[model samples]
Structure formats: C-alpha cells, structure tokens
Target: MSTFQTPQYTIVELLNKAQCGELQLPDFQRPYRWDDERIRSLLVTILRGHPMGVIMTLKTGGHNVRFKPRPITGIGHEGLKEPELLLLDGQQRTTSMVQALTGDGVVDTEDARHHKLRRRYFVDVVKALGDVREQEDAVVSLPDSGIVTGNIGRDVVLDVTTEEKQHAAGLMPATVLFDSARCFAWMMGYQQGAPERMAVTQQFLSTVAQSVQTYKVPAIELDKDISKDAVATVFEKVNTGGLRLDVFELLTATFAGDGAYFKETGEDFRLAEDWARTEEVLHKHPVLKEMRSTDFLMAVSVLITLSKRRTALAAGKTGKQVPQTSARREDILSMSLDDYRTWAPQLRDALPRVARHLRDLHIHESRGIPYSSQVVSLMIVTTLLGERAEEHAVRARLNQWFWCGVLGELYGSTITTQLAKDAEQLPDWSLAKSSTTPEAIIRASFAESRLGSLRSRQSAAYKGVYALIMAQQTPVKDWMLDQKLDFQSYDELQVDIHHVFPKKWCEDNAIEYWRRESIINKTPLAKKTNIRLRGDSPAVYIDRLDAKGLSAEQVDAQIATHAIDPAFLRAGDFDGYFQDRRRRLVDLIESAMGKSVVRDWNVDSESTDAPANFNEPAASTGGVSIGGEPTPDRTL
Candidate 1:
C-alpha cells in the first residue's frame, strides 16, 4: 500500500470531519494567536482567490506512537473517538476558519490561567463585493470591519455604510453562512416582501457556498516509515510563515510522548502544562507581564545550560569556562524533557529579579523597556552573582548600559547575533575580579547619528528618551488638574503626546511635516491642554496662559522642565528653537551621564556627529540607585 494518501478537502467537509471527531488537532499544536485583523485578512485572501498554502495532516495509525488527539474547537463537541487524521500544520489558518464559520472560540491551550477564547468575526458583503467581483466571488465567514475579540460578547453591526438606502445591507453574521438551512431561512426572512431582493441574496449566498465547496487545498502526506523527528523537521520547514510553530512548540509536542518521564515524582510531566505555568509566572511580575512565551523560554535555556556548566566547573570536570552564548535553535530543538522540567522553576525564580533590577533603572513599564533581549543578560548576571548583583555600583553600570543600548539601538536590528555577543560578557561582569563593564560594550556599539535622527514614536531611541525624561525626575505636572503628574497612571487617563507647536500652526506657516513631527517637538500634555492649544503658536499659548493669571516665570519654568528653550517661544522661532532645544537636551543627557559624551548638531544639520571619545566612560555621579529591597518573591 502507498504509505499515505494526498487528497483535497473543502471547507465544509473539513468542518464536518472536525465536528464529527474524525479530524482533530495534534496535542502539541500551539494555541490560537490570531487577532481579528489576521482573521479578516484570511477571509479577504480567500475571497480574492489568493493561494493560502495547504494544510498537512498525518494518518493517526501510521505513526509508531499512539499520540493523544484533541478535537477541533469552535464546533460543539461530539463524542470523542479515535481521530483518523491529526493536523500537523496550518493551525493558525484552520483555527481562524473554525472561528469565523462556527462563531465558536477554541479554548486557549497556552494560557492555563485563562483557558477561554471568545471572538466574534463578521464580513461586510457590501465591502467584500467591491474587492471581490461576482465573476470570481465567494461567501466569506465573517465581515471585514468592526472585529472585536475578548472574553465578553460585543454586539456589532457588520455593515459600516452610512447612506439611508443601504440600511438593508447592514452587518450580516458570518456564522450563519456555514449552515445552508439557516442561511436560506435568514434570506427568506430578510427578503419576505421583495422577490427581486431575495433572488439577489440567494445568488450571492449560492456563489459563496459553491466557491468554498470547490476551493482545493494542495497537500502532502508523510509515509508510515517516517520517524517522529522527521515529522518535526517537515513541520518546521513546511510552515515558512513562522506564525504557527517554534522550537519550544515542537519540543512541547516531542515531550508529550515521554509519558511518566518523571519516575520519582509520580506525577506525569507534560511540557504544555509546564510552559503555561512558566507564562503565568512571568505574567505575575509587574515588569515582565509584557514578556512573550518565546522570551521566557530563551531565559529558561540560559538558566538550564549555565547552571549545568557551573556545576560541571565546580566538579572540575571541565578544564576552563566557556563563554555562554544566547539560546540557539538547535539547543531548543534537542532539549530533553527532564532538562525542560527543571528549568521552569529556575525561570520562575530568576526572571522577576531581572525585572526588579530593570524597574530600579526607572523603566516603569514594558513600553519603557528598551529591549527585552537585555533580560537574557540580566538573568545570567544576577543568577551568577546572587545578592551582590543588586549592589548600587553594579546597578549603576547596568543602568548606563541600558541607556546606551537604547540610544545606540543595539538590540533594534540583528538582535540574535548581538545578544550572543552581549551574553558572552556576563561571566566577566558577574566576577568581582574582572574589570568588564557592560557600558563599554554599549559605548562601542553607540552612534550619535541615531539620537539626532530619531523622529518616530516606534523607534527604540524614542522610548529611551521617554525613560530618560522620567529618570531625571523632571516635574511633569498637570497644571490644569492642580496635581502632580503620575506617568504610571497612563491607563486610567489618556496622556496626549501632542506637538509643542500646534500642527495646524505649522501647516498654516507651510512648515515641513517631518520637522513638525520630530521628537524634539513632541511632549506629553493633558488632553485639555492639547485641545485648548488648537492652532495656537507657542508664543500665543504662552501669552494666553499668562493672561489666565499664571506668571511668566511659572510658564517658563513649566516649559523648561519639559526641556523647551523658553527664549525660542519669542515670535515662534521654529528653526532656532529646534537647534537650541536639541543642544540643551543633549547637554542634559551628558550631565545625567556625568560626562560630556554627546555632541551637539553643527549648523550644517548634516554632520551631527559625536566627539572622538564617545566610547569612554562618563564621569559617575555616585551611580544611579533606587528604592526597593531585592527580595526573591516580588509579585505584580
């Protein structure tokens, strides 16, 4: 017999098999991570005749191992049976279809704390028509707009058009399209009085169903002789999008076969459960909540390998210490179940300490965290040095390094190689005998051009600037509210990062949009202040504030605290203002660093380069330190 069969299946047929328990997901597949935008995009791709790649499945009895099978979610459960086929790849696209078609959410297998998934997807037939012509159009599961995903149900109208005549074409629930009887009934109810309208709706629905029923997905089935490792290799190679699977995910599936691997504990060890617990631990940390499972796994790799190496060194089994590198793909792929199990606790203990260390450096939240790869280095250094890692001297160097990494944009691009090199220095930094400073490495990587060219809110340097603003204890007061500004309470009230000179004023004066949008012109202001300053020049607003009984000194002090040059406010000297402010800001940065490290922009604006000693250590201002005792169990 041929080892396997390659056959095509329609969307309806796949959903039926899944609902009937014949088609199921493999136990090791990652949880559904598709947001509404992705789901909507998939529908658009399908409707427009785009080739979404084929899904791969394995014959259940063909493999040597009796793998545990899971019924596809979003459809109501049928009695569990031996699954005939197991989905090996395309979980993301497949899960999206199930959710869109059935309006059922798959339980998030990754999040143990919250084992629920609820999302409502819809499709705007009116909108989909413009993009998809009837010459080659089909029905989509959901509408293109107003997609809302969460635990709670939100009532949404699918149609977004505003004309009075299009009222009948309002949002249609995409889930009804999966059922012919329901769809027909809905059409009958919708077009009861108008036969012509009914005919049109019927034609549209029929075309959609026909398209889905005839759409073919190409496939390749593995022969029965294929080994489990081969399945993993093929799975990774086939899913080139990198959205569905990773080393940790593959390992999670690989370890699933090693049932009762922990012989001594009497408790069966499952990689998926352990992975979720690790995520839960990271989620509980105030600074680490923004961390992804992939990031946590990288740290876990360090915790496992480094500790083992340390033990080997202590035993004199190894002649000399080797510099540790960042976690590699091969290291994760070849990880043993036992090693993975032990590393979970170490990660739970070590990573929060890394967060606390970062928090002390005035990185209040994840957005303030310049590069998460810095966590890997922090984990290794703290784990090696123990309590002394949190010493004032040690933290100051780390703080300086953190800023340098941000300003230098060290981890912005080419992250993996840079992380490997940075990780090599941890051993030296951990030892008191060595004179290695992380700041030196950061300085070598630093470039003055990055700081001068910063304009976008998305750039790493922009976040670093915000962190620096908070670090210097700049008095960011809310004059309108008569209260001290608490930057941390950003979630409670919207903090507007508005232009110092109103955009309308800039447009009126025909100023370049890029100059108006520069980081130099951006500052956090209250929504009220932003709205009230509409189209007003800086000079005009300052005068208005003065008219409201605020003295000139008070206005100047507030603006100065925000790093603005008060002299530039005279007649709105935009060019001179930017130059002066940039100079003073660079000065403040050097003063904060306790050295004249940063160079100001020359008049030419093209050659804003730094001094020759850009890599030298700035004079220390007794080092950056903060409150908070280094305790082992810090929770969110």
Candidate 2:
C-alpha cells in the first residue's frame, strides 16, 4: 500500500495554497530556527530558479485523522476550517516562503523557547545580483523596528531617514513581487521622477518575478492512511533542514500523523502546545519558572523509569535487572510516541508538587538549584512519595541526597546514571528511615585543597557555597534600594554580582587577577550599589556609609550576616583578610548544610605579598563587637 503523490510546485502555487489555508504545519514541528544567513541563502537559490528542496505533506479529508489547518505565516484565524494538506516536513521552507511572499512573520505562541525570526523581510534586488553575486547580498530580514531606507547599501541597513533620494536605489519588499498590482504600485512609487531608471528597474524586477513564478519545489504527498510512525521514519530519512530531528521531535511528528485533535476545541497533538503549557505551570511557581521544556521532559523520564522499576520489584519479576546509566538515557531517548502522550499529563500534575518540596529545603528559586539532574531525581521522588514526601524520615534522606549531590558534584557529568542510581534507592531509602548523611557520602572528596581553590560559578561546589550564602540571607541588599537580596523579585530588581573588594581597587593596588577575581570575592547586590561602590576599598565605602548614618549596630549586623570577618573592612592585609573571610564563609556554608563539611582554611593566593603602599596601618583598631569579637578599623 504505497500512498504517496509526487508533485512539483512553482513558488506562486505553493504560496497560494498557504494563503487559502490548504497548507498547514503539523503540531510537533519545531518553530522556525533559520537565522538571517540561512533565510537569505534560501532567497538567493529561489531567485536563481534552483530547486529549493522537497516539501513533505499528508493528504486530508478522507477516513484518516487530520490536524486543523492553519495559515502559514500570519496569526491564527478562526475562519480556517480543515486543511487539504498537513505539512509533515518543509515547515522552515514554507515559513520562509510565506514571510518572503506575504510579508507576514511565522508567529510562535506555542513554543516556550525564544525565536530569532519575528519581523517582515525585504530583498535588496541590486545587491542580490550584482557583478559578484554572494548569498549574503540576496535578502535582508528587518529588525523589530522595521525597515530603514537611509542605511541601505551593499547589504541590509536599519534606518530609513533618507527617503525618496535613495528611491533610485533598488529596494523591494519581498511580498510585492507576488502580485502584479502591488508590484506595479511599488515600482511607480520609486520610479516616478526617473523614467529611464524606472524602465531599467522594471526590467530587473520583471526578471525576479519570472524567476519566482517559475521556481520549482519538489514535493512528496503522503496518503491520508499513512501511519504516524511511518511519517516519522520518512522525515528522519529525508529531512534536509540544518538541525537533525531529535527523538522528541520525531515523536511529535508521529503523534501529529495520528491526527489526534479535540473535535470541539480544535486542539491537536502538538507537543509544542503541551511544552508551552508546562512552561506556564512552572512560571506560576517562583523556583521552577526558569526551567526549559527539555528539563520538564527529563523529569518525566525519571518518573517513568522509577515507577517502572518499583512496579517490577513489587511484582516479583526476577529477570528484569535495572538498566545501566547510559542504557537508562537510551531508554528515555527511545521512549515511544504513545508513552510520551500517556506521561505528559502526569508530568504537568507532578512538577509543581516537586518544586514545592524543593522550596521547603531552602532552594528558594531557579538560581539556587545547582543542576538539572538534581531537579529530575527530586521531582520523581516527591511525585512518587506524595504526602509522604514531607515525612521526617523521607525529608532526612532527601536532605542527605541534596547536600551530597551538591557537594559531590554528582550531576556534573553522565547525569543519567547518577539520576537512575538515586531513583532506584529513593523508594527504599525513604521507607527505611535511614540513609548516609550527605557529608559521609561525599567525605572522600572533601579536602582543604578543594576549598582553597573555590572555582567559577559553573562548578557545583561554588553553586553549593552560593546556595548556602543565599539560604543564610546574607545582608547584601540591592545597590539602589532597601529590599533584601531575593531571587523571587528578580524581574523587578536589577540585582548584580558585586565584589566585596571592588575589582578596580585590586587592579589599582596591583593585585593578581586570580585573587581579585575569585568566587569568594563576589556577592549579590543591586546594580546601583555596585556602581556606587565602583573603585572604593571596603574601608572607604564603610566609612562613607557610617557618615551617611549607618549606625554601629547596622554595620555589625551586616558583617555577621554576610560572614565577613572584621579584618575584611580594614585596609591592606589582603592575604589575611581573604584567608579569614574564606574560613568564615566556609563555616557559614557548613552551618547551612548542618554538617562540618569544610576541610580547608588556607587562602590559595598566587602571591602572598601585598603592595608596600597598600599595607597602611589602621587609625583606630577598636569598634562595635560583631559575633562576640571587637571589630578592627584600619586606615584607608
């Protein structure tokens, strides 16, 4: 039962079908990923009358299921009924054509991912075909601000302040060539005064029109009876678009092939729709809002893996051993379209509950979560355990898991295996009321060497330290306002990573880059405070604050809350201050984790000696006592 029609379509006919709602994209196809370079290269090929590529479509209006037809380029229309064809492949080509011919952008209201294509595109006819024709010269997509005429030249320009004088220049809206009348009106608008130029321009445009009219795209039409799985296979075999289809995308196409749509609501099996809905759900919770669709999918995979294993164990199935980590990842990769469809609903319901559980453990927001792997295991554990998730024993083991995962950098690489191991242990561990403390699990890796070289923010250990800093509510507020540092209000507050010892000050004092740029030196403060603190040393800034009526009590509170040693506020003593503060910060981190996990107290300074001029003695060494010690005031 071969059910396919091979056809060749000119650009004109292809666009007309799109305009009449006869051509539609399947729900699972990813949104347009082509950048301006790819789009322009496509236009160059089309202008030269070259075969763009094959478009794959599925026929509709038979006994087979079908997706609701949609206009190719514009916003959605309620007027569209059923489409005669559902695009299985070639969405990128169709979308580019629609934008080039109709001047409408391919809107993306369904995918949560950011899109690069949004504005209408125009072609520079002169540049597209000059003495030296290059792909870059063919077409220019406009920015959000639209076209600017004055800046036009070799390539696309942004502003159009110089209007009619440049009209002698050949700039044509990509859509104008589609219709004779619109094309004529456009030519007349620019060709009014210069009749000779108009004739020349008209001839050039005419050639373009002919090129567009005659350009052929090969297409294969699948019969309505084609199975969704077969459609996925075909796309995998023949897809020419730059990004190869991942399994998620393949399953999406498979489901769309099934044409599972709600008859009353007109909703279809668009995986993007489900992904977008999951994003919406995550957005309602402060901690999960920043998660991507891939993250959500991974959480679902963990849930599926664990639930299956637990069920098998309970049923006394002796032969089915748990898959290895790489094999577990493969299991997720090979998940069937039907399985994805079945599990998506459960994922949507379970994810929020998981996020709530994370919040109880002081992972206040997305920034506080160290890795995506941690989110997967936790999401599954919380989902499977439900009300028992908050039980004393479950909480203790989960806490151990959290700190151990963070400190050990458990999810840094080959995360699937680690997640599988955690998932396998969680059901039993939660029920047993006992598990190894996070400190004990990662005890071998804990050392003074690890603490001395506090790595970049990307390191899990650094993020672990940061999580503790955040959990302790370090009294560094936004530079501009009185609001305490909070990740939940991040949108409204322009908080920035600030240096406790300003970088410029270190540079001015000839400090080495490593010591100046250490993670231990950075803290989160509002943007305004960072600017205000600019090049001042701690002593100068603290003095300025004191004069601004920063009470003695307030200064003491800031030092203790932020784990800053009194020596840090003094001038010079850079090595000693770093050492003192590093120990203090490590202690604070250990306190938050409820374990004596910090094994290092030495500062890993590249050079131990400070500049001779920088080591000035303090004017007054006595001040307010903080955390039971008298503060030292050094010379600025």
What TM-score against the true fold does each predicted structure earn?
A: 0.59, 0.59
Residues 135-253 of candidate 1: C-alpha lDDT, one tens digit per residue: 22333333233343444656544432322222265344556555677656666655666666665566657775455445666666656455555666676578666654655566665
- Cα lDDT tens digits, model 2, 1-636, are 678999988778888777777787765566666556566667777766667778899897644334444466553566665678888788887887776576443222221244544555566756655544553575665653454445345555455323353254566667766666766666677667767766656665678666676778899999988754456567667775555555456545544545334553464467777788887888888677766555556656766666666676777766647433322434555554466767677767777777766665545666656665567667766766767777777776676667666765555445555556666666567668445433324431444345445545545566676656655645444423446665464445665456778888898888766567665677666566667676888777766555545674565465555566645565546667777767767666555445565464333442433233223222223321111111222000
Compared with the true structure, all predictions reach lDDT values of 0.59, 0.61
RMSD of each: 13.3, 12.6
What range of 10 consecutive residues in model 1 has the weakest lDDT sum?
A: 627-636
lDDT of 1: 0.59
